[model samples]
Target: MEVKKAIIPVAGLGTRFLPATKSMPKEMLPIIDKPVIHFVVEEALASGIDDIIFVTGRSKRSIEDYFDGSPELEMHLKQHKKHDLLEKVQDIASLADIHYIRQKEPKGLGDAILRAEKHVGDEPFAVLLGDDIVVNEQPCTRQLIDIYQKYGRSTIAVKEVPKEKISSYGIIKGKPLDHSLYVLEDIVEKPDVDKAPSNIGAIGRYVFTPEIFNCIKETSSGVGNEIQLTDGIRNLNRSQKVYGYKFNGTRYDTGDKVEYVKAIINFALNNENMKDNILEYLQDVLASKNNA
Candidate 1:
């Protein structure tokens, strides 16, 4: 079965970004000019995904509006002869067949994904977390989808984080299925440094079989009194095969304040319009700091 749908969970109340996110969705926060969520959607589109199900919440109306047609803005751009900008704005809505389901409460990732059950029906689907932005020569979700095609099972994207940082993510323990793949034995969510099973931490991309919905339905709430997607995936592992892929990419954890700022700086410095000026400004800041 070809994977044609993707679910993006963007309903989290980003408390980490406090005052800014208090009014705006963290997914709306810009990396440079484009919002972070746009990159996730762009990746899904690049990977041949036709339908996108955004599991969103109340304050995330901006996300919906961002992808919908901005008639007034488009008219203004057209009047100003800004053809390039107008096309860019118009392309957002044209990217995919976007559907939305409101996650009524701030539940866990599992709950967010479950919200898309009706939209997904019985098809295999991809899940991409809005908080993690992955930049690669090939899309991260595409990498997992390819693995799913080859193995005829679910696949999760993994990357080796520092041992000390393993406690921050769902750590996996598994032997190599090949150079870039692992047959996962178990997954430990937020394990302590000493208790961590392995340094291979789960990234944002996932390709899941339809059987996953069954596991999610039966899954009990784990930590934080919330249904964790990790727990559901672990349950799915028992009855079916779940593999992990060490995806090739640079993942930015935009949910973190420091990382968000770093992403802004990195993306800004790489922009065609701002690269030289931004690099010069950065060099000046560094030189002045040393002189001081």
Candidate 2:
């Protein structure tokens, strides 16, 4: 079956981004000119996803509004003859068929996904984490979706992190199903470097079958009393085939401060309008610091 729906879990309390995130969602934070979540939605749309289900929370109304039509702003732009700007605003709302469900509590990733069960009924769907932004020639989710079409099994996006950083991610131990695919055997959530199954770590993009809802219900809280998604996928692998794809891309964890700043600089330097000036200014700043 063609994958037409995508679920995005955006209910996390952005504790890492404190004070600033007190009133605003971290996903709304900008990387250059576009918000983090906008990039995520664009990725889903680029992969032919027709419907988007966002598992959101109370303060996330801004997210919904961001993708909705803004009549007053549209009228102002139209009257002022800013045709190009007006078209861009209208295009945002027309991107996809967006739906939202409130995740009442901060249960976990597994629970966040479960909230979308009704909307995604009986079909395979994709899940894209709002914090993990991948920039490449091709969208990251599209890469996973292409793999899903071939195997017709659940697939998780994987990437090689340093062995020392394995404990910070869900580590997987599996055999190669193909060059970029793995027949997942087991997944360890945050294992010590020495004990990690492999350097391949789950990076937040997933294409899962409907059977996951049952596995999630059977899974008990594995770490931090929070129901982990890795546990459910591991259980699903026991009976059904689950594969991991070592996706190709530069992924930025915008949820972290340092990486967020790096993403801003990298994106800014890549922009056609700003690239030359930004590069020259950066070189001057570096030269001044060296002389000082």
Candidate 3:
């Protein structure tokens, strides 16, 4: 089966980013020249996803506008003979067939995904958390999708985190199918370090079957009286095979301040147009710090 649609839950309040996110969606925050969400959307598009369902919230109109056409800007650029820049602006609008719906309340990732039930219908779809940016030789979502196609089961992207950080993410306990794949036996949401099942922490990329919606619907509120997608995936394990693929990639959690800065620096240092200038600037800054 060809997986064609994806759901992006972008409605979080981004409390970690505070005043900067006060009037802006964290996904709208620029990594350098592009918003964080742009990278996510580009990943999805590159991975053969054709339709994007954005589960959004209030004050996120800018997100919609970013992908929508910019007539005035395009006209000004065209008039100024900045054809390259004008085409770039025009390209955003043609990237993918995008649709948006309100998440209504900031429930949880499960609830946010649930909002896409109608749009997703009976097909297998993906859920890409707005804050995770997976940089891989192959797209992270596609990696999971390939696993899904081979095994005919839902798949989640997993990567090892520090043992002490297990409590910060959903930890999976599983038997190894291979060095990089695990047949997930269970998932524990934010367990104490001593009690954690494994160091395999679940990240944001998931390729779920329609049956997942059933699991999500049946799942009751969990900790903090919220619907957790992790809980739903755990429940899905009861009747179906769920696998975790420790994907080949480096993932950046943009929701964290330090990681966000690191991601930008990493990208800038590798970017063709910005590498030399950014490297020289960084060298000077470090030189000054050492002198001080």
Between which residue pairs do clashes occur in model 3? none
lDDT score, residue 152, model 3?
87
Which of the two candidates, 1 or 3, achieves a greater lDDT against the reference?
Answer: 3
TM-score list, all predictions: 0.97, 0.97, 0.97
- TM match of model 1 to true structure: 0.97
Over 1-292, each residue of candidate 1 has an lDDT whose tens digit, in order, gives 9999999999999999999999999999998789999999999999999999999999999999999999999999999999999999999879899999999998799989999998899999999999899988899999999999999999999999987678778999888978889998999888999888889999889999998988988888877788899998999999988999999988999998888888888888778899999999999999999999
Model 2 clashing residue pairs (backbone): none
What tens digits encode model 2's per-residue C-alpha lDDT throughout 124-150? 999999888998888899999998999
Candidate 2 deviant stretches above 4 angstroms: none
RMSD for each model, in Å, please? 1.1, 1.1, 1.1
Q: What lDDT score goes with residue 123 in model 3?
A: 97
Candidate 2 global CA lDDT score: 0.92
lDDT, candidate 1, equals: 0.92
TM-score, model 3 to reference: 0.97
Q: Could you give the candidate ranking by lDDT, starting with the highest?
A: 3, 2, 1
